[model samples]
Target: MSRFLYLDNAATTKTAPEVLEAMLPYFTEKFGNPSSVYQFAAENKTVVDEMRKIIAESLGAKSKEIYFTAGGSEADNWALKATAEAYQAKGRHIITTKIEHHAILHTAEYLERQGYEVTYLDVDEDGKVDLEELKAAIRPDTILISVMYANNEIGTVEPIREIGEIAHEHGILFHTDAVQAYGHLPINVDECYIDMLSASGHKLNGPKGIGFLYIRTGVKIRSFIHGGAQERKRRAGTENVPGIVGMGAAVKRAFDTMEERTAREKEVRDYLIRRVENEIPYCRLNGHRTDRLPNNANFSFQFIEGESLLIRLDMKGICASSGSACTSGSLDPSHVLLAIGLPHEIAHGSLRLTINEEISKEDVDYVVDSLKEIVEGLRNMSPLYEDFVKKQEKNV
Candidate 1:
């Protein structure tokens, strides 16, 4: 308990020992460019292809359909921009939720500047997009609909299959930013009718600089990167052999242990949720109760700034988040929390705890205890809490 207890797995995971072992050989002994024609590099090329096969099988995709990228942001950017450019002749309209990661949101905005029309769908109080509203938003010129499989901030699992069905019914291509959901959840591209999916290796306990985009067979997307032929000319760059091997190892282990891991994490997550709600007054859970990620538990404590709470938690040897790590430096309130109907002040106080397979019930208990002390201590000094207490008493 004296050591750092990391509860920020949603931002990035600690690379597993097995994954590091799998990558070490590639970094030293097997280091070679897959694009090289020499036999020395051919072995690395074979290893790369094997890694691709492992990731493809994990997503129920074919090896040729998987394209590796620098990380999730690159994959998401590629999915939106490349698909928009390639399909502009078919339509110039794209649709996505307001609560997507900045990669998607910024890309959508850029596409809008490029003369494409975009529909930013609104989510309900539980952070779920309405399928009916989505259906109503579609137009004859709609080319694509992009949504996250799981939210990074609040951990709400969107109804991807339903969204996919709605998109396909209208002949529009569907893309999902599955960076948060990829290794944690069981996703079969065909079963879900997903045309494109983005994922990052770091989110799944693999190396940070590597990720992949699963582009369904026959889906046309223009090249996002331009250079020597790589990724079958879909993506162009020297492959990250070590990172790819590590990702394959991580993904394989995830698949092998997913069911057990998910069950355990869910049990601990629910228990933490229950304990926090019972122990802490004037705190609200941010995401849906049941239809949320097994690893994520987000809450907004009244009358406290999230940054201050995070600092106190860090002092207690617990590493949590106010919101997405990508936006942790920003002073603005969490857009995800705001989209889910939280007021600006409540959103500013949000805390996100994302559990990993390594976390235990004992760890959750310690976190809850630490949180109780921190919230109470912070509230004792807050004039807003005093005002809130007086207002409640007056109402009573």
Candidate 2:
């Protein structure tokens, strides 16, 4: 078997060496609770504060606006629940898109069960929200609007700035789950009209288990984590000092070489797309060609089960997936693809191939070649394909 080509970066990334190096000291010699009063505690406190400033700068936000959390899920839960509690009197309603990550979608559903009205707007075939539907969904009682910055499965970038503006026009707070978009593209809170934003560290080569929520100045949100005074009381408890430190370092490196990294991923990503299309038969590329993450490449092949293909690819030392990791357990088709109007059968057969900076042209070629072989072999075994071939022969 060939060296495992890791093309599933959307799931999680391997921590960068620089990030690991930066986080080392916090685990042992520098270990101290940021909340302690002693010099040792003050040292960790100061370091985490500096990490905040660096991460804030990357998002074009002030250090005061950054609130650390367990991960993207916590940030998202906080953004939704806190915003709802803070403004429930103004409106008990919230608006969001249908293709969002389960973090936001499930949270919104939970809010619905708690008596909040949630309006789930549908996306177009291109995985874009209907601005007109958005215009219609905003009621006088609508208190918040949360949209993910990108679709995790198919890599569709949303019109978040416009959605944010629409929410603001109605005096409603706006939030975006930028876990997938934070390091992949440029983000500015003011320019995008975002009032609350959530991001995860691991998506950008930082260690997992740490993330941040950005609350715009003057935006009121109730605290989700009720505990000791920390994160200026917006978030509570001692921070993950090492993980936060690694996030800052990873963020800095990503920005320093962002353009170069994006360009390289784009080149290789496109090469893989073209190679698969030319080499494989009956393949349908999912998601927009240009308005997607530079590293994402999703496709569906007829008469081939995505899960079966995944296993075969894994055996061949090429790692990819049948869509978002969160949605893999159930046999249900991916919600993102379904929201984009794919039939359930086609959606079930979808594969997402995400490339990272470490992936090379050779890796892409290997996956494409392996995919062609797998799809062909699977189709040969598929009863549906055999029936189709038999019917075609009779017609001829």
Query: Clashes per prediction?
Result: 0, 0
Give the residue spans of candidate 1 off by over 4 A: none
Q: lDDT winner among the candidates?
A: 1
Q: Candidate 2 overall Cα lDDT vs. reference?
A: 0.90
lDDT of 1 at 158: 97
**lDDT for each residue of candidate 1 in 310-386, tens digit (9 for 90 to 100):** 99999989999999999989999999999988999889999999998788889988999989999999999999999
The stretch of ten residues in a row with the least summed lDDT in candidate 2 is: 1-10
lDDT of 1 at 281: 91
The candidate 1 region of ten consecutive residues with least summed lDDT is 1-10
Q: What C-alpha lDDT do the candidate models reach, one value each? A: 0.93, 0.90
